[model samples]
Target: MIKWVAAFLGYFLFRFPGAVLGFIVGTFLDNFGGSGNKASSVFQDYTRQSVSPADFELNLLSLCSIIIKADGQVNQRELDYVRQYFLSTYGKEKANAIFRTFNEVIKKREVSAQRICAFMEQRTRYEVRLQLLHFLFGIAQSDGQVSKAEVEKLIEIAGYLRVGRNDFESIKAMFIEAADNAYKILEINKNATDDEVKKAYRTMAKKYHPDRVVTENEAIRKGAEEKFKEVQKAYETIQKERGIS
Candidate 1:
């Protein structure tokens, strides 16, 4: 892990030669048992409370590429959505570098959702994974409508990410409108009583809260905020329809 983080920082900061230098340094640290305390504050910057943020960004790019191509037709709006997201979370220069890396590397590769999610499943927290779903859905729906191909691809990716079926359905309901979408977003059934509906709303509100995702990354926290809003919207929709407010 140290080696991976080091290599990323090296490359991100200095490109190829720096990557080799970083790998050598990381290997030395690992051999000397530096992970306990020898890891410098600089190293810790990459590996925060959770996985390496740099690593997460690379994996996120992979997933973004997959979803963008899912419908077989790439829309400019979808492309712009990704670009705008990066620009917002990271300043223009960093965002441009990130996208530069993406276009040069990730765009050329053959993305395998199963493989990407397999790594994410082990490394990512549940709340963070849920936020990933929300982000992907936004991509799929950015072009005014989500194609059938995109939906199927998203489901497959969710399965690989090991996201629970109900959780996936709950997020899906936010973007795909349906008669029972509000109930689904609450992870409840229409047959649920008013009391049960209230309970479900509480549960979902807690689950989707932005604070649930432990991350310093503004983009991820932003995604969680969006999910949290969807949950609130769902609860409101249900209350209005049932006259239970």
Candidate 2:
């Protein structure tokens, strides 16, 4: 077991080459001893190395391209929204570099939304997938409205990502304004009692909580935090409407 762990540590050390990788290797070794069949499955799933940060960024920008062009035209407001996201996550220099690459890809229109989503579904965790969906919605609504074409494209991409209908609707409510949007955001019904609303809020909060994303990637965690805030805002909106504290 010592030799096995040492071998893994050595490989990870060479592959990842950072303190975070060290911590991950240590955790893997600690869990490997007690994990059983389930642990083996987990090791196989996570240890294969999920998408790298660069690849994730590229995939995100590629998908964003699809979203912005959903209405057959790319709006500056939509591009700005994506640029702001990259700016906050990667800072000025890297964000500009990414934007340049994104523009190049956008001009070529070569990145297939279905293919990118498939890669994400196979490589990313559910929390990450949810975050991606949320980001896409933000892009869709950047022009102050989510057109039917945009929503249709988003639905198709969500399907490719294997995101559940409930989860997709939950995120969709955050952006697309409607009379019963608050209820949809909370994944509840208009006729639901205050107590039921509260329970639903708690359930959605737990599911979309940023802390649920266990990754060293700060950008991914930040994206999850945005979704968490959206869930909280939805709950608050319902509370305001129902006069529930």
Candidate 3:
């Protein structure tokens, strides 16, 4: 429906907060307007939209392909991780449609991470781009250990996506464990003052809130929720270390 497209664009343009606005406005138009399938001015400009939603899926597949081949050996667990996540988040039919492209076109060639990241940076919101990085990390770590080449590839891809060093490190910490990784996840220093830790927790929580990307999709919400839980875990770890309740 045009309304779903509108809702998706709203989220795509403004992040998750705008999804409700788009859906409500869409319903209002559906009830009050005529029976034509024309798009409203509020829905789209058509000219400005160089990237379609389908483009997101394709570019995402490209990123996955790049990562899978990063270490020069394809691990079935990593491949299964990618496929299962897609199936759970996007459903069976749609996941199959995407995998068809992945197995057919994307895997057949050397996908340029630069080209895909360039396309994504032009069209995606920062939060969504962060999610993309997180997804790649998830794939890399799915097989028990992250190979050095895989981490290097992920860092390079993050650079092309324009993700800052801290943000990239934070996502990396979520998978690649370290002693002070919890601090890294919160984007705070290991010796940050208790008050500073509290402040950082609040900030990161808001940034990674489930509502930020949870609109209209349960599995997507779960993805955001997992990130949010990491922020909580970081805060708790710091709190316990400092004996602050």
List candidate 3 segments past 4 Å from native: 1-50, 214-221
Q: Residue 220 CA error for candidate 3 (Å)?
A: 5.4
Candidate that scores best on TM-score: 1
Candidate order (TM-score): 1, 2, 3
Q: In candidate 1, what are the lDDT values of residues 1-245, reduced to their tens digit? A: 67878988899899999899898888887755543543232223333234456777888888888888887766789889999999999989999989987786445647788988987887667788889988999989988888899999999999998899999999888898778999999999899999999999899888888867866667778999999998898889889988996
Which candidate tops lDDT?
A: 1
TM-score of each model, paired residue for residue? 0.79, 0.78, 0.77
- On a 0 to 100 scale, what is the lDDT of residue 154 in model 1? 93
Clashes of 3: 0
Candidate 1 accuracy as lDDT: 0.83
Sequence-dependent TM-score of model 1 = 0.79
Report, for every candidate in turn, its global Cα lDDT versus the true structure.
0.83, 0.79, 0.78
Which ranking of candidates, highest lDDT first?
1, 2, 3
lDDT of 3 by residue, 38-120 (tens): 33222122212245556656787888888888999878898899889889988999889878987865457577899989887
